[model samples]
Target: MELITTVIALGGVARCTSLYAAGFSKYRIALAVAAGELVRVRRVWVATPDADPFLVAAARDGVVLTCVTQARRLGLWVLSDPVPHVAAKPHAGGIRVTKAHVHWAAPLLPRHPNALVDPMENVLALVAACVPFEQALAVWESALRRHTVERGALERLPLGGRARRLLTLANPFADSGLESFVLPRLRWLDLPIVPQAWIAGHRVDFLIGQRLVLQIDGGHHVGAQREADIAHDAELMLLGYHVIRVGYRDVVENWPRVQDLIQRAVAQGLHLAR
Candidate 1:
């Protein structure tokens, strides 16, 4: 049970010799292996068959998952990019990364010898260097929203100019990257914009002033969720809330139009409860 707990805690993958140090006898490990409880990556690594393939691959190729790939694995929202990102130690050469985006930047925190997943600190640092400013900010804000990393902790690091600015804008209150992007863009508006505002028995994505409620539908907003949102929008309207529901794309791609609509609403005094 100790061996199983150790492997599960390690995200279902670890070096074959790792179990020995955790007090599992070599004979016990061999017995488990023979019983099909673990699959050996080589002579040195072992993983449960259900372990994440990406993590197992990173382990096999000797790199720590980093940047957007790691961010996505941690459930942070990032711009879609197919290429996997991995990191190696600064001085460690002989890495074959024909299949991944390899980052050779030295980690901010110490990494372990068998690190398949990266520390959140390293993941954000690599993301700051690898992605564009807006996208990186989104991921950073998402991490802050999830409390995966604290803004104060990241602020204390020797971050570059762009990263420092992003940290300043990151609000742990924002629910998603879409919310993060929308909040900063609308900062030029001199009205109170509250996120996750409860009104008409639903928590809106944002409530501008007292009546204007904004909702950004993410990619996964479909079927049952779509029906539920529609129902809530009607309820909000009955309660005199101005609902502005838009797709996540509108916030990212067609922002000027959204901005214009919002401006008009504010001009018409629709944001205020009269």
Candidate 2:
């Protein structure tokens, strides 16, 4: 019972060496395995029945789950959840490479011999290299918002190229990944865009200039939420603000039309305080 409890405490999965280091005798480990208290993973690791499948697979393949894969696991927003993105040591050999994006760069921090997940620093670096610019920035901002990694700590690292550039643009104010997407596309307009700005007792997604409020309805905008947003838009208009409400598809799939709408609004000085 104690052995099973210890395994569960060790994140439901642990290397055999870690277990031994914790003072479990080899005979006790064998007995636990034989009694079905633990399941052996590829001879070196053992896991409880309810271990995270992703971590289990990482252990089996001798890789650390990193990049967008780890980002999603950390509750940071990712544009998409594709196949697993795992990291292996640059010189690692005989790894199981099947249906997963393998990152072979040296990690920014040393990985523990028994670790199944990459450090947050390494995850951010890999995300910068793996995904497109906007997508990577969204993930980075999400990390900042979640306090998964400190912005100063990330900046202090000896980052280069894309990672450094993305850090420069990454801010913690985005309410959603969609906000991350919208602000950068409109940055070239040389207008001030404040995200999650408070106005008229509610928060707008993006406030461009002084009076233009952009509201983004993400997946959670439905039924009462939709009605409430409509009410807020009405209130804003009555108070002399222009509201441009957009859906996920509008901002994502049909962005050109959305940009045109904003440009027309700005052309008429709608963004200016009336």
Candidate 3:
């Protein structure tokens, strides 16, 4: 039962040998497979019948899920999920599935032979290496927000140029990937920026300068949350604070326009509560 639980916990599938470390023998695990209690993913892997399709496919393809795919599976805020990203050692030899986005780089830390899901460290490292800076920063901030790995621990690893730079910029206090994406871009404004800051009885996404509030709303579109956000904007305006509210698309897809708006607000001296 313990081995069965462990496999499911590991994204619903894991190598058979890993259960051995938990006191289950190959014979016992095989017996469970025969008894219809577990599905034999292959000669060496076992899973519940309801394992994730991606993990099953990764297991079959002999690749580890990494980058945005892994981050999304870990419940992080990913900008989009167009392709299933997988990784293999730089020279893992011929792979069955070459159609998917495959990263041929070896992980900073070694991956086990049976790991269907990449470790958080490997996922972040790949994300930093492969994705654009803005997208990568969002994932890094997401990992920090979830406490999957800490900056101190990541610093201990021998990270390369980009990963090392990303580690330095990572802030766990960031509440969302949007906050992660927005704050760094606006640093050129030469003013203080505080994220997840309490203002007007609610936590604004960012408080720039003395009174300029920047908010990035999620993609939920209109509902109770939107109404609440509108009320908060009103409250902030009444309090002599300038509020710049933009949707998720504005931050991700139309950032130039959003930046222009912010720049105009700053030029107007609206950031200061005169």
User: Candidate 2, overall lDDT?
Assistant: 0.91
In model 3, the worst 10-residue window by lDDT is: 91-100
Ordered by TM-score, highest first, the candidates read 2, 3, 1
lDDT of model 3 at residue 270?
A: 90
Report the lDDT tens digits of candidate 1 across residue range 1-274: 5776788788899886678788888788788789888877756788887989987888788888989998998899888768999999897977887878988887888899988888998898888888877788889988988889987788788887877888887777777788877887888998999989988777899999989988999987899999999999999988888988898879889999899889999998889998
Comparing 2 and 3 by lDDT, which wins?
2
Per-candidate clash tally? 0, 0, 0
Q: Is candidate 2 or candidate 3 better by TM-score?
A: 2
Better of 1 and 3 by TM-score: 3
Candidate 3, 1-274: lDDT as tens digits: 6777888777688877778877899888988898888898777778888888898888888898999999998999788878899997787776868568998886878887877888899999989988899889889988998999888889999898999989899888888888888888988888998889998688998998999998888877379988999998999999999998888889878999999999999999998979
Model 2: per-residue lDDT, tens digit, 1-274?
4878888888888888888888898899889889888889879889987899998899889998999999999899998867999999998889977999999999899999988999999999999988999999999999998899998899889886999999999989889998889988998989999989999999999899999999988999999999999999999999999999999999779999889999999999999997
Q: Give the TM-score of candidate 1.
A: 0.82
lDDT (C-alpha, whole model) for all candidates? 0.86, 0.91, 0.86
| Model 3, TM vs. native | 0.87
Q: Which ranges of candidate 3 are over 4 A from the true structure?
A: 1-11, 18-40, 220-222
The candidate scoring highest on TM-score is 2
Worst 10 residues of 2 by lDDT: 1-10
- Which candidate number would show the highest lDDT if scored against the true structure? 2
User: In model 2, where do residues sit more than 4 Å from their true spots?
Assistant: none
